[model samples]
Target chain A: MNVKIDGKYYSGNKGETLLELARRNEIEIPSLCYKEGFEGLGRCRLCLVEVIEGNSTKTVSSCVYPIRDGIEVLTNTKNIVNMRKDIIFLLLLRTPNNGYIRKLAEEYGVKAPSRYLDMEREEDCILCGLCVKACEKLGTNAISLVNRGITKKVSTPYDDASKDCIGCGACAEVCPTNAISLVEQDGKRIIWNKTFDLISCTRCGKCYSTEEVLHHIDEQLGVKTQEYLCESCSRRLVGEKFKEAFQNLI
Target chain B: MAKGIVISPDKCTGCRICELACSFIKNDSFNPKDSAIAVLPYDSVGLQVPMTCLQCDDPHCMTVCTVGAITKDPKTGVVKVDDEKCIGCKMCVSACPFGNMTYSSRHEGVVKCDLCDGEPQCVKLCPSDAIEYKELDGPLNKRKNIANLFSDVFGEVAE
Candidate 1:
């Protein structure tokens, strides 16, 4: 199907979303919550588009808007640009120190905060849900949104050690604002303030995976975890064992 | 892309984006109230579960439909509600064991998942693969009980 985006016609598939279509045509629309090959959600209003169908026109999220034939979509209009600026201004209030939000705001010439809108500087978590979603997608729902409204923050249950947390570090990897901190302390890795004990390789004595991570893996794969060796050591041992078995059989 | 949706409660993060996507796709607006899917959040236990139409082989909704408005697809085995034929009696809604069926205030009729004609919006929009659309190899069914009411909003977790 052909979708008219910014007065230019772009070819898209039957099930393509406006975000996917615009991105294919090299159209620039800033989105924080969208990731490649993963589904887009109701969060992140950055990819708004003015969808015009003849006499009717309304702004809709391009990230979730299903692309159809003969619909006119404007990526950036004067009114849309102004609206986006306000949204950026609000986001700046939430994650003031974040460079990603600031960099986008800078593109819109939103360099600094106005005197009347001064707020205290804070951490970078914008509550985009990418980290939480990434964790869920990785088969571990360790971290989630805790509390409500302004007090809403990413944390484990009771703000204590999480039993479901496997310490895969997928949450830290996908955080848009670089807010999630995964730190190693006393052989236990702390992710989102949840501590998980790390398992070490027997030969090299190098910590490879968390104990919970190994257990979770074992549960998923329906196999008993025989050894707790790092990837390389395990492979080396397997190779040696195979050679020894062959020699004995020969 | 085999049969129907599969819910893994452990993988759910209670984002409710699945609900948002379902509502928007159905109504062209974002409202969880109009959504076919609902995420029951057990915050005390830090557990989130996505609940929706399980599309059972012998569906209670289909059986209890007084007007015979609900029918199952022969090919995909998806149970669907035909609104044009529906009398709005809400028999199917009450008879539904999973409580997956709901009354849509916007549509003035009962609403349930049609699997989006085989490409479910909930599965497509779920950031976590908690809700998935695949071939059903076994009899994985959902039966609602009194326990669901407490577990959906808030339930205690043993420390």
Candidate 2:
């Protein structure tokens, strides 16, 4: 199928979305909550683009909309710029201190929108659905969207402890505004701390947060009497022990 | 007709997303050890070089494979391993120039990039457009352009 994006005719595959086609053609479109190889959640509305010749010519999410034949797509029009600026402004008013979000807003020259109502909560949850997708798709249901619209949150049910949480920290990793954090507690357990550090292993170069090491024996290795090592280290240690054991047995 | 992956160093921000995506797509988890793509970071220089299967025309890995498991895809020009025919040899792993090919612990066979069937997920997910899918000749020009753009943006590359 042929699609005209910014007056350039391109061949698009059947059932391919407009966003995917645009990306394949090297068209730049800003997206926050869209992750490739996963289900599309059009919550952020950051990837809004104008379909110039199609019936849906208004600002529509390119990520979710499939590419139709002969459709004219304008990715960086003045209206899209204005809408993105306004959306960023409103998001900034809700979340003021996020460095990532603030930087994105600054890139678009957006200031905080005026407060519409007094409806503000202690916690900031823009409901981007990254946490939910990370849980459901990744086979670790550590979080989910609770409550109905206007009250929905990417949270655990009843704010209780998650039984199936593998603590992969994918939820916190994907959060755009740093709303979720996996916290390490006194080398015993992990909890949601709202502050996170994307720590990497010094030895093997694996990515893990500080909270992931919370219940790990390595967390108490230095302080405690018994030394705890990671899987690779422990394997070497175990090999040495087995060698000694075999000699003793002989 | 061998296909190779070209990485633009100037565009790379050392995010290691390519490594993660490679591992996830191949291994079904986020373990970099299983990933065929390797990102080597030089902290002193603040630079990262992502190395992977080049699928060279005169492929060393295919020549070294004793059981003749490694073969080049005619259509995509990507080197792929016939896992069913593989004998779990380490010759191909040793023959790799970039040290990107590896023996999969799960499969007990050598694994490398198949370019994700020519629709590489890493190229799609890269935030800075650092990684791009193009013909072998096209990627070099693209990298040169990106380096010029980077030099213009950052003033000068650090020595």
Off by over 4 Å in 1: A114-120, A238-250, B1-159
Count the clashes in each prediction: 1, 0
Give a tens-digit lDDT track for model 1, residues A81-162. Answer: 8878888888887777788888888888875546634557767888888777666655567778889988898888888877
Q: For model 2, name the residue pairs that clash.
A: none
For each candidate, C-alpha RMSD in Å? 19.8, 17.0
Score residue A187 of candidate 2 by CA lDDT. 36
Two-chain complex of model 1, DockQ on C-alpha atoms against the true structure? 0.01
**Residue-level error in angstroms, candidate 1, position B54:** 39
| Global CA lDDT computed for model 1 | 0.71
Q: Score every model by TM-score.
A: 0.56, 0.52
Mark the regions of model 2 whose C-alpha exceeds 4 Å error after superposition: A54-56, A113-124, A192-231, A234-250, B1-159
Q: Write the per-residue lDDT of candidate 2 for residues A90-207, one digit (tens) a residue.
A: 7777666667777988999987545642335344557788767755654446678888966777767677666656454556655667687656553332544233343443445443
Leading candidate by lDDT = 1
